[model samples]
Target: MTQTEAAPVTAAPVDAETYAQIVQFYSHHMQLLDNAEAEEWADGFTEDGVFAQNVKPEPTRGRDTIAASMRRGVDRLKGRDVVRRHWLSMVVADRVDADSVRTKYYAVVFETPAGGKASVYLSTTGEDTLVREDGRWRIRHRLINHDGA
Candidate 1:
């Protein structure tokens, strides 16, 4: 295959380069959230992306709304001098189509107050539908469920 041609994304497993790219994508994506860059983090999603959690009555739809929701939480934490971090691990990707991937992973969230020790805030699992937009991976839909709930 030529360098420009993508290796097929299959049920067995993606090639090393493809897997590395997925890991790199999540690393940068989560770091943005950890750093409280809400708008930029939300930009990792498609324009009509959806985020749904088990605790919420309804899913947050649209990239703009997702950013707004994140902003509210970040602002509230900042008021109390607290910082939140998200860690995603155990990622497994399945090719949904030529252009889309479904990733499932474990997530742990930590919160730290100014001069205080960090504590686990939440433990969950996330399944996301990812698509390439403009040659970048963007979330099209995300579903997160609390570990014990």
Candidate 2:
């Protein structure tokens, strides 16, 4: 209980339940995109939130625009009937507040073609962000900075 022994905790460690929800929210986003469920993917954000890919010059904002942008991309791959599985591990979470948390995790996407036995590498993130809204966790912003060339 000594003052010197206490390092004066500045950031609170995210609890297991909250941590799981954050992970689930991120996984859901990946699933929506993989399934080409554009609208569902956009719905994961807040009304005015954004989804931005750092590789792209512009970021997608608002639900309608986000959905449309995603739709365009999804349309390109729609015919392929591809499925992507997200691998999330090495998660690190920092508490912004009691209700808000910022989590960073390593992720890799494996693309599987319909009726195909082999899988191909699609993308790997730099990271993503999630927020708690309406007592439910959802992705408020995603800044996917892919490194794989």
Candidate 3:
């Protein structure tokens, strides 16, 4: 093998119980954001978690910054009396290590204004790094790519 090419690492697949827990974790995590519980949603991340979107120039790093960003979006939507719902599906996870997993999922967000019909607001696919911390799953990093972008 060439020195430049790295060898693959062997790791066990995430167990059934652990995989189920991860799925459940995403249910609550996405709901928190959809409900505009910015602070609470951010609490699901590690202290140095990162959030990145393809449309954005740079990823937002740190739990505090991520919370602040969510708060702003929540406030803006609330001002317009718009409610957002996130529908996440097609979750696939691969174990990176005993404590970390890489997840890929599809998310579609629908928004409804106070007096308007619901419409699709955004469609994206995301890959994230999740870590088991203190007996719970927390996002270590997230990378989202807009379906159109």
- Cα shift from native, residue 26, model 3 (Å): 1.0
Error of 1 at 135 (Å): 1.0
Against the true structure, what is each candidate's TM-score? 0.88, 0.79, 0.89
lDDT of 1 by residue, 26-71 (tens): 8899999878899999999999999999989999999999999998
lDDT of each: 0.87, 0.71, 0.88
**What lDDT tens digits, residue by residue, belong to model 3 across residues 16-74?**
89879988998898899988999999988899999999999999999999999999998
**Per-residue lDDT of candidate 2, residues 30-94 (tens digit):** 78777778899788877777777767889887778888888998898777687767676667777
Assess the local accuracy of residue 110 in candidate 3 as a C-alpha lDDT between 0 and 100: 94
Candidate 3, residue 69: how far the Cα is off, in Å: 1.1
Of the two candidates 2 and 3, the one with more favorable lDDT, higher being better, is 3
lDDT at 105 for candidate 3? 86
- Which stretches of candidate 1 lie above 4 Å from their native place? 1-12
Q: In candidate 3, which residue pairs clash? A: none
lDDT of 2 at 28: 74
